[model samples]
Every structure is written in C-alpha cells, then in structure tokens.
Target: MKNRSVLVSGASIAGPTLAYWLSRYGFDVTVVERAPALRPGGQAVDFKGAVHRTVLERMGVYDEICRRSTGATDMVLVDAHGNERARISGDFTGGDVEILRGDLAAILYEAGAGHCAYRFGDSISTLRETEGGIEVEFENGPAGNFDLVFGADGIHSRVRRLAFGPDEHFVRHRGYYYAIAGEPPHREQSDGPRRRESYAHNDAGRLAVGSGAKAQQMYLFAAPEMHFTDEAEKRRVLTEKFTGMGWQVPEMLAELPVLDDFYLDALARVRMPSYVAGRVALVGDSAYGNTLAGFGTGLAVVGAYVLAGELAASEGEHIVAFARYDRIMRRYAKVGLGSSPGPFLAPKTTYGLWLRDRFLGSRWFGLMEKFAGDAKDDLDLSGYPAWEAR
Candidate 1:
C-alpha cells in the first residue's frame, strides 16, 4: 500500500468524498473545515449520467442517497400572480436523484468519518511547501506537515490564494448573486407531486426555488458583485433586492435571519492555469467550480473520485496524479465552467426573461434533458478501479 498523509480543506461534498477514497487507498486523510459543524445550507444538488451513479455506487452511498432523495419530479415556474408559466420536470433537473446539498455532505461524512480525521471550526492559515511535504498551520489548531494538501475549499478558497494567488485572479463573477436558507415548508403553495414550487419575478430578476419538508429557499438575482462581510448586511442586501417581489419572497426573506444554515455567495467559476503547485493540489469548487451556474455537485464529486484514483494509481506521486486529473477534467468541465446560468436563471431584461420562458415552454426542455444526460457521461471513469476495493 502507498502510505501517504493528505490534508483536505472543506467538509462539504468534495472534501469528505476525497477523504473516503484516499483513506481506502491506504493514505492518511485529515479534513479541515471553517464551519463549527457540517453546514446544512444550500439547495438540492443532482447526480446525473452513468459516471456519477457509478461513483456513488462504488462509494457504497448510492442507496442511502436514493433513500434521502427529494423525490421532486416537477418544478412549476410562476409569475407574480402565482400563474404557472413553465414547468421543469425531474427528468430535467434531478437526473437520476436529487438530494439537498447538506444531506449529501452528511452521508459522505458518515461514510468517511470512521476512517478519516475531521477538524471542524478551524481553517488553514498558512501552507509552506518543502521537498518532503507541505507544512500547514491552522487558524485555531496546531501545525502539521502532510505529503499533500488539497484545496477542496470552494470558489473563495484560501488554499488557492496561499498556493496560487488571490481569489480575484481565479474566481470571476458571472453577473449574478445567490442565497439559500431553510424555511418552514409552505405546504399550501406546493404545485407538484412533491410539496415544491419555483417562483420567478421576471421583471425583477429574482428566482425562488424550494422543495420537500423543512424546505430551502434558493434566491438568485442579476447583479454586479457587492462586498458585504456582515450577515446582517448581506441579509439587508437580499431583502432590498427581492423587496416588493411576489410569490413567497417576503416569507422567504423573513426566514433568513433565523435560518441557522443561511448561505450567500456570488455565482462564479474558478479558473486556474493548473490545479497544483508543488505538493499542494486543489479539487472541486476550488479548481473548477461554476457555482450554481453549472451542475457542480456532480462535477465536484467526480473530480474527487478522479483525483484520489489518480493519486493511488500513481502510488502517491503528485505530479503524475495532478496532471492526469487536470487533463481528464479539463474538457469535461468546460461545458459547465464556460456556460453561465446567470442569464437563464435571472435574466437582467424583460426580453431576456421572455426568451427564457419561451425556451422552457417549447421543445427546448427535451434538448435540456439530452444535454444533462450527455454532459454527465462526458468524462470517462472506466479505467479507474473502484475506490472502495482499493
């Protein structure tokens, strides 16, 4: 067995999933998160295509994910007056299965936590690389050195900044900002088989999406990125943006302050010349995140699978593994990273909204279905051995 120690930043989907595979391959894995605990914010994330399903099955969490599936087969797009203008079916969004982002993280953490080390409420402060390994210091914990360190940390990755440069150099705003927070289910507003409804104020450039029990409200708006560090300030911005909007906007905003898992961020993508520097590497959102602009949940999971598999295949040689991961994910990630959902989800102009609704109301839905399935299968996972069997 290739015994090496690896430190992964971020406790969300990619970090834990990578930890699971690395541990299975006989590598010592430690995951560090800034949050005090597993963050249960964000909206539902879907898994599509054969590769995504195969990876989950290999990890032995496929069944559990299905059990927790949102089971939402349809989403109704409503106007200010609550008139259904368009419908997006489960066949369009969920692919095979869709689960809340937090739920998926919990499952991945459960699968890997037994074999890996998890440090919550802490973050890497500095990472200095040497010939032997990368020395890491945490914000609230002791320092340590590992054979490798991965920045699975999301778009605003500290590791990426420490290893590469500032986030501005890598993360580009795509003219949209989004927020997700839990709210008590408004069972009365449900318009589908599942208690779910998606409201869009076309003229206001606002979109609200939610599903299932103890639902999450996802709010997106077309805007230039604004800086707001305080939670109250952020909430103020959100309220102002969606103020006077119809179809549950007021209710969703009211739930923001009390929502324990409120998450807010600009919709953007991380672009890098390479995903590695010396012994340090990056995965998931830190490397190829298109934020909500793309099907990043599946992409993040697949990236972790490929990254760990490559490391094992190379017997812990980072140069070989990193290069292979980049090459494999480069082409596959373009369909997402290059395409922005800002225009489609929150169009800036009335004409843009009309055009978007036109497509959704037409045969474009079938094309979207085809695109979802085809995009999921774009990468080849055939050569890598099953992670658990390693």
Candidate 2:
C-alpha cells in the first residue's frame, strides 16, 4: 500500500472523483470543500466516447449514474410565444447517459467517503513547499502536511492563485458570459410529470430548458470583459440584460433570488503553461476547464483517473507522476478546448444569431451530426493499471 498522503482541494466533481481513484490505489486522500455540504442544481452532464465510459465503468457507478440520468436527450428551440423554431435531437445534444452534475458529484462522494477523509466548510488558506512534502494551512481547520496537494477546484481555483498566480493570467474569456439557474417551469401539472417546454428566444439569445422538477434558465450574451464584484451586482446585470425579454424570462428572474444553484461565469477556457509545480499539481478545471463546450465533466473524470494511475505506477513519486499526467493530458486538453463551440453558441450580432438559428432549422445541422461520428476522445485507457484491472 502506498502510505503517502494527498490533499485535494474542492469537493466538487473533480476533487471527489480524484480522491476516489487515489484511495483505490492505497493513497491517504483528503478532500476539502468550501461549501457546507454537497451542492445541488446543475444541468445534465453526459459521457461521449469509450474513454469516458471506461472510467465510469471502472468506478463501479456507471449503472447507478445511468439509472439516475435525467433522460432529456432532445431539445427544441422556440420563440417568445412558445412556438418551436428548431429541434435538436439526442445525438447532437446528449452523448450517451445524461445525469445531473450534482447527482454525479454525490455518487463520487459516496464512493470515496469510506476511503477518503472529507472536510467540509473549510479551505486551504496557505501552502508552503517543504523538502519532502507540502505544508498546508486551512481557513477553518488545523494546519497539516501532505506528501502531495492537488487543486481540483474549478476555474477560479484558490490553490492556483496561491501556487501559480492570479486567475487572469490563465483564463481566456471567449467573448461571452453565461448564467444558469434551476427554477419551476411555468404552468405546471400535478397529475404526473410536468409537460415542460424548452423555449429559446432567437432574438434575445437566451434559453430555458427542462431539468427535473425545476427547469434550467440559460442567459448567454456577448460582452467585452466586464467585472461585477458581488452576486448582487451580477444579478443586477442579469436583470438589466433580460428584463423585458420573453418566454419565461420574467418568471425565472423572479425566482432567481430564491434559487439555491444560481451559477454564473464567463464562457472561457483555462490556458495554463503547465499543470504542475513541485509537490503541487492541478486536476480538472483548474488545469483544463472548457466551459460550455460540454466536455468539462468527462475531462475531469479522465484526468482524475490518469493522475491516480500515474501516481500508483510511479509508486508515490509525485515528480514522475505529475510529469506523466501532464504529458498525457496536455494534447488531449488542447484538442478538446480548441473544438469548443462557445463563439458559435452565442454570437455577438443579431445577424449572427439569425444565421445560427437558420442553420439549426435547416438540414446543415443534421448533415453535421451524421459526419460527427462516435469517436471523439482518443486516450488509451489500457495503459493505466487501475483501468486495466477493472
């Protein structure tokens, strides 16, 4: 058994998943989360290629994930008065099984809890590199030393700031920003499941899609680098941008204050020179967060698997493990992030939006899908011992 200790920051999707694999490899893993408990209310995230499914299958949670999947594979684009403009099917949208992000996180946490130590409502305050390990100071807990530390915290990673530098140096904003929140669909039926309508305002460039009991309200717009310090200011901007819009926009705004999972961020990608430094390394979004490209979740899981496998293969030598992890994921991440459709999703001009809608409504979209093929990720999972054993 590998006796080295590992500290992973952020108990979200990546951190918990990484902890799971590391624990399986006999590493003493600890996951620290800033939130008090497991957070809920994120849209469905799915697996695409064989590589992603292989990792999930190895984790032994694939069946459970499929069972809990939202099964919302098709979406229709509608105008202000709830009329369908264009329809996108399962092939273009959902890859295979699509489960809610929160549900997936819960599954990973449950699987890892027995083997990995969990610290909630706490965060790393400071990190100092020692001769043999990294010394960490917690915001709410006592200081400790771990053989290695990882920053699996999302794009706005605190560990990145402490170890690397500010986020501005790494994140590249792709000319737009988006906000999403789960809210009750308008005009519900109590007899059975609500017959929800996925509406999109072509002129407004906003969308409202069905997601369980509450639907997800999507607000996307093109902007040139603006800053809002607090949530109040962010909400104010959202209100200003979407006040007089149509198709449930008014209702979603009304429910925004009460919604627990209101998340907003720039539709950006992280571009780091390197993902490691000494005993500290980064996984998932901290290293490669291609927001709105629909590949973040899969990348997180695969990255976690590779990081743990490399550690186990290297026998707790972080220097070798980190280098191999970087070498394997760097090109994969580059290709993935390069293919992000952020700019195409939310075009700047009204003409661009009209063009986008026209394509969606036309045969071009279908033709593109036919050529898309099932082969996206190309990572060789067999090389890793963890995956091979499974």
Task: Please give the RMSD to the true structure for each candidate, in Å.
Answer: 3.2, 3.4
| Predicted candidate 1 versus true structure: per-residue lDDT over 321-380, tens digit per residue | 889988888877776676777788777887887888788877776887687678779877
- Which pairs, if any, clash in model 1? none
lDDT by residue (28-125, candidate 2, tens digit) is 89999999999865776877777888888888989888767666456676677877766667556677777778878999899889998999999999
- Give each model a TM-score: 0.92, 0.90
Report the backbone clash tally of model 2. 0
Model 2 alpha-carbon drift over 4 Å, by segment: 1-3, 183-197, 204-214, 361-375, 385-390
Error of 1 at 301 (Å): 1.1
Candidate 2's error at 3, in angstroms? Answer: 6.8
Instruction: Measure candidate 1: CA RMSD.
Output: 3.2
TM-score of 1: 0.92
Residue 75, model 1, lDDT: 65
